[model samples]
Target: MNKNIVITGTSRGIGFELARLFADQGHQVIALSRNADPIRALDHPNLHPFATDLTNEQSLKEVTQQIKAQFEHIDILVHNAGALVNKPFEELTQADFQKVYQVNVFSVAQLTQLLLPAIPKGGHVVSISSMGGIQGSMKFPGLAAYSSSKGAIITLSELLAEEYKEQQIAFNVLALGAVQTEMLEEAFPGYQAPTTALQMAEYIYNFALTGQQYYNGKVLQVSSSTP
Candidate 1:
């Protein structure tokens, strides 16, 4: 079945690969990113690249408005855009925290809320979280802001699942382990992760296709012992 899928941060990394996979599978992909060149380079007819800064309220509003105008219902929404600020808790300022939250929390909340009208029953919402945000886990240094933002996403998804069950909308968060993406590399230099962006993208694409049928309000942790 051809589904309407919206993905964020499609300029590169896991989101980019996901867009490619979805388009290849014949689904309509609305790819949102600050830069649309990479998405446009895909040259997939099913891919519609929209350049919009997720952290900017006006930009998000315009994109969401355009989406609502064009699509009656969004079958899937993958919130893969995130910001990571690596600084010691004490070194991190209010502005730093706000910047991370703007992309990881506020913008996601805003976009999802605006797009809800276009998400009918059976719609699935998945946000990419991090293992750092997983509760009761080993804490990493210099990741307080990023981890907290992800934790908020997990909580938000759980709450949304319960609140919108009547509407049959499903919400989930994927707490990803270190994937060999720019974000991971930036956070952990000279470290080789056990997973690659393409691998993670494949995993997410499969889950987005049928996750609602079996899971909601679940935070699935994905990782391995070795690369």
Candidate 2:
């Protein structure tokens, strides 16, 4: 059956691929991103690309408003937007942490809260995290802000999952390993990751559709290896 889906960070990378995958499959997809041009260029009837700044509460609220105007219920919500500042802890400023957290954690919570009413009993909220955010996982340098923010969302999802369990809405986090995305290229120039954005998006797309049936509030590490 066709379902309504919302995805963030659709300007590029996994979010971009995921939006296309769902829309092409006849699902109603709301693709949110700072730069809406990429998704907009697709011009798919089922895909609605909205310009959104996840760090801004008003911006996120507006997205929910648009959603309410269009769909009766949301079957899936993917918090795929992220902010990464690859800098040493000593060099990282308070603003850097705030910016990263604002998008990676705060916005996820804000958007989810706003869209909660529109999400039906069996809705799935999937948060994208980094493997570096996982406890006991290998950590990298110059990612204190990015990695920490990712970790925060993982815990946030867990908490939300528990809080909303009775409502039957499943909240889960996917801690991803290195994927060869533009973000990775910009952060670790010249480094190659085994997985591509499309490959990872395929994984996320499948999980978002069916993973909730088996798990809720769980953090699944979706990764091949670390670089």
Candidate 3:
């Protein structure tokens, strides 16, 4: 069966790859992002692109309403928009922390809540977290804000899964390692990325299709070493 999937941050990175994969597989994909021009160029028969600034509550609400009106129910929801601010703790200002939290945590929670009614029973919600959220790596110096926000995402997904267990809504967090995306390049300019976006996207799509109850409320870490 072709599922109706809604993905955020589809303008690039893992989100774009996932959107392409789902559409190619004959699923209906509604992609929301601040920059939709690239996604619009995809113009796939199964792809629908919506320009949305996730940080804007009003815009998000309107976008969700449109999605509900068009699909009635969403089979899968992928929250993939996030920000990375790497700097010394002293260099990080309150604005930096607020900006990261707004996009990574606050907006995500709000959008999920707004769309909860449209996510049908047995649907799945996937939040893209990071290995930084699971465990602290070597002292990165200036990743406190980014790591803290992702930690909130991990906790939020777990709490949502438990709260909506009766509704058959599975909430899972993907704590991914380095992937070859613009974000990675921006974070570590000269460093080589460890994984391709397509590889990560393929794995996530397959996982979503598995209907595996065991994944519910779980945080799965995907690393370059993982099979």
Which is the leading candidate under TM-score? 2
Per-candidate Cα lDDT values, in order, are 0.93, 0.92, 0.88
Provide the lDDT at 45 for model 3: 91
Worst 10 residues of 2 by lDDT: 55-64
- lDDT per residue for candidate 1 within 83-155, as digits (tens), equals 9998889999999999999999999899999999899899999999988889987678899999999999999
Candidate 2, backbone clash total: 0
- Give candidate 1's error at residue 102 in angstroms: 0.5
lDDT of 1 at 64: 94
lDDT of 1: 0.93
TM-score per candidate: 0.98, 0.98, 0.96
Model 3, span 69-150: residue lDDT tens:
8997898999999988988898999999999999999998999999899888889999998887885543355788998898
Write down the TM-score for model 2.
Answer: 0.98
Clashing pairs for predicted structure model 2, backbone only: none
